[model samples]
Target: MQQITGREAAVAVLNDPRFVVPPVPPGASGIAWLRATVGRFSSGPAHDRRRALAVAVLDAVPPATLRTGGGHPVTVLARALGIAEPVMDLVRDVAQAYQPGTGDESRADAAVDRLVTILGGRHDEPTAALIGVLTQACDATATLIERARHRPVDEVLHADPPVRATRRQAQVATTVGRVTVQAGEVVLVGLAGGPAFGAGPRRCPGWDHALALVAGALARDSPSVHEGTPDTAPGTGRD
Candidate 1:
C-alpha cells in the first residue's frame, strides 16, 4: 500500500466535484491520489468522523456570524455527527465567548460552565480535552486573520501556479481572489477583500480546497478515537 499524507487527501477533495462544485483540477497522480485518500476506508464510524470534521473546518466562521441560534450550521454539523444539540451549543458558546473583539472574558466562563453542566462531573476530563481542541481550532482562525494583515488583497487569494487540474475536473483555483495561511491553517481571502469565513452559498468562490483543508486538518489533529489520525482510518468519531 502507498503512504497517504493528510495534505494529499485534502488535494483529492479539492479535485472532486461530486464532493463540491467546480472541483479543483485533477492532478497528474489523480487516480492514485484519489484511491489512496478516499479508498482507505469503507463507509463506517470512521468515515462519519472524517465527514463531520471536514464540515466543521470547511464551514468555520465567527460564531456570531455562523448562525448558531438553534437552526444554523452548528446544529447541522452536530446532527451530522450524531452529537446532542446541547453539546454542539456548548461548543459554539465557548468558541463565541473566547473569540477576540467579542469582548468580556466572563462570557467564555459562562460558555464553559454550560458545557460542564451539560456533561456533568464524570465527563470532566473528556470535556476538558474536547474544549482544548475546539479552543485550538478557534485560535487557529484568529491566527490566520492576523497573518494576512499586511499582504495585498490579490496576493491573499492567489494559489500557487501549476495547480493540478484534470480534464474531467471543473475550474478550480482560477477564480480565487485570495488565500491565507496562519501557521498551518488556511483560509481563503475572497475577491471582495473579505476573509471568506463561512461564506454563504453565493459568496464563497468555491469550498473544494477549503473543505479538503479542513477535513485533512481535523483528521490529522483528532485522536484515533475522535476522528482518526490522518495516516490511519480518517473515521468520523465525535470530531
Candidate 2:
C-alpha cells in the first residue's frame, strides 16, 4: 500500500489510466450488489455506463435553493429523485454501509430491501443510480455543512475536506511523484490541500450539487440569516 500526499502526485494518480478505484466484492446481493453494480467500484466501460446512469439521475433532481423548515439534504435529495417517501433513516442506514467494509451490512441490506420496495422494486442500474445518489449525498453533504460552520464552504473544502483520502489500485507498475507503485498495489490518494473536487474523467460528478446543498444548509444555520440563496445566483449560468 502506498500513501500519496503531494498534490501533483494525487492528481497524477487520480488522472492516470494506470490507477483505478479499488474494486468492491461482487457476485452477491444487497450491499455487496450495490457496491459491485455502482460506478464507484468499477472501471473501463462498465464505469462509464454506471457513471452515466448516476449522472442521469442527478440531471432530473434539482438541488434545493434554500434550506427550508423541513429541509434536510437527504430529504431534499430523496424527494428530488422522485421518491414520494424519502425515509431519512433508511437512507442513513444504507449510507452507513455505502462504502466498502464500513458499516453493518446486515442492517444496510435490510434497509436496501425496504428502500427497494418503496421504489417499486426497480432493480435495474437506474434504481442503483438513484440509491447511489441519495446515499452518497446523505453523509457527505452533512459533513461538509458541519465542517463549513466556521468557515467558507470553499475554504473548508480546501483546508479540511470531508473525504480526506481515496483509495486507488495500480493497474500497472508506474512512477507517481518520484515513488514507484507496483502493479495491484493500493495507493491512498490524499485529497487534503489538493484539488477539492478532484481532476480527470473519474472525478466526482456531484460537486456542484453538493456545493448548492452545503451553501443552502449553512445559510439556514446562521443566526442572522435563516434563508440563503443557492450556490448559483440568478445570472450565474444555472442551465
Candidate 3:
C-alpha cells in the first residue's frame, strides 16, 4: 500500500480516471457487502447513480430541519425518509462497521437488516441510498459534536477528520505527481491533514448538512446532550 499524503498528490490520485475504488473480494458478505454496495465504494455509472440518489435524498431536507434542536441529524434524516422507529442504535452499529476492522460481521449484518426494514423493507435503490446516508453521517456527526466541545468545529474537522483516509486502486499504470503507480496497487489518500471534507470527485456530499448539524448541536447550552444519548430522549422528535 502506498500512502499519498500531499494534498495535490492525493487529489490527483482521487480524481484521475486511471484509478478506481476497489471492490470487495469475491465471496465477501455481510458488512463488506454493504460497504461494497454503497456509492462511496463504487465507480463508473453505478457510483454516479447512487451518488445522485444520495444527494437528492439529502438535498430534499432543508438545512433548518437538521438544526431545529429536535433530534440528532441521523435520526432526523431517518425520520424524513419515513422510518418511524428510533434509529440511533442502528446508526451506531453501522458507524462502527465503517471503521476499518472494528465491527463484528454478524452484528453489522443485523444492523443493516434492521435499518433496511426501518426504511420499509423494499431493498430497492432508494432504500440502499438512504442506508448510505445514515452510515456516512452517523459517526462523523458524533465526532464533530464531541470535538467541538474543546475547539472550533472547523479546526477540529481539519485536525481530526471523521474519515481518516480513503483508498483507491490503480486501473492502469499512471503517474500521480512524481510517483509512478502500477496497475492494481492501492493508494491511500490521507484526509486528516489534507482538507476538511475531502477533495476531488469523492469529496463528501453531506458536508453542508453535517456542518449545519454540528453548528446546531453546539449552539445548545448542553452540546453533550447530543453526543451519545439514546434516541429516546424527550423532545427528540422529528423536525
Candidate 4:
C-alpha cells in the first residue's frame, strides 16, 4: 500500500485515470451490500449511470429549500421518493451502518431492510442511489453543523473531514509525486488537506446538498446552544 499525504500529490493521484476507486469485494452482505451499490464504489459505465441518477435526484431539490428551513434534505428526498419513515431515523441508521467497526449490526441490518422495503424491496439503482445520498450527507452535515458553532466550517472540515481518507488501486503502473506505483498496488489518499469533496471522477455527488443541509441547520439553530460544546450530534458514534 502507498500513502499520499501531501495535498498536491494526493490531488494528482486522485485525478489521474490510472488510479481507480477500489472495488468492494464480491459477496458483501448487509450494510456492505448497500454501500457497494453506491456510485462511489462503481467504475466506468455503471459509475456514470449512478452518478447521473444521483445528480438528477439531488438537483431536483433546490439548495434554497434547505437554507430557507424547508426541511431536512433527507426528509425532502424521502418524501420525493414516497417513503413514509421519519427521515432522521433513517439517516441515523444509515450513518451508523457506514461507520467502521461501530454501531449495532442487527440494528443496521434492520434499518437497511426497512429502507429497502420502503423503496419497494428490489434495492434497485434508484433506491440505492438515494440511500447513498442519505448515507453520505447525513452525519457529515450534522458534524459540520456541530463543529461550525465553535470554528469555521472549512477549518472543521479540514481538521476532521467527513471522509478522512480514501483508497485507490493502480490499474496501471504510474508515477505519483516521484513515487512509482505498480499496477494492482493500493494507494491511500489522506484527505485532511486534500480536496474537500474529492478531486476526480469519483468526487462526491452530494456536495451541494450537504452544504445546504449544514447551512440550513446552522441558520435555524442558535449559536449560543452549540458554542464550545463537544460534538454530541446524533449518529456520531465511533466508526
Best by TM-score: 2
lDDT of 1 by residue, 188-212 (tens): 2112122222222222221332233
Q: How would you encode candidate 4's per-residue C-alpha lDDT over 199-231 as one tens digit per residue?
A: 777777777767777777777773432232233
Which parts of model 3 have CA positions greater than 4 angstroms off? Answer: 25-33, 223-239
Task: Please give me the total number of clashing residue pairs in predicted model 4.
Answer: 1
| Candidate 3 backbone clash number | 0
Better of 1 and 4 by lDDT: 4
lDDT of 2: 0.71
Ranking of candidates on TM-score, top first? 2, 3, 4, 1
> Could you give candidate 3's per-residue lDDT for residues 47-148 as a string of tens digits?
888888889988887767677654666776676666678987887777665534655667787888777776777656677678878877676676667778
- The TM-scores, one per candidate, come to 0.28, 0.87, 0.85, 0.80
Instruction: Kindly list the per-residue Cα lDDT of model 2 for residues 132-171, writing each as its tens digit.
Output: 8777777666677777887877787777776767788898
**What does the lDDT come to for candidate 3?**
0.68
The residue pairs found clashing in candidate 4 are 100-239
Question: In model 3, what is the error at residue 185, expressed in angstroms?
Answer: 1.1
| Candidate closer to the true structure by TM-score (higher is better), 2 or 3 | 2
The CA lDDT of each predicted structure is 0.31, 0.71, 0.68, 0.67
lDDT of 3 at 194: 56
Candidate 2 weakest ten by summed lDDT: 230-239
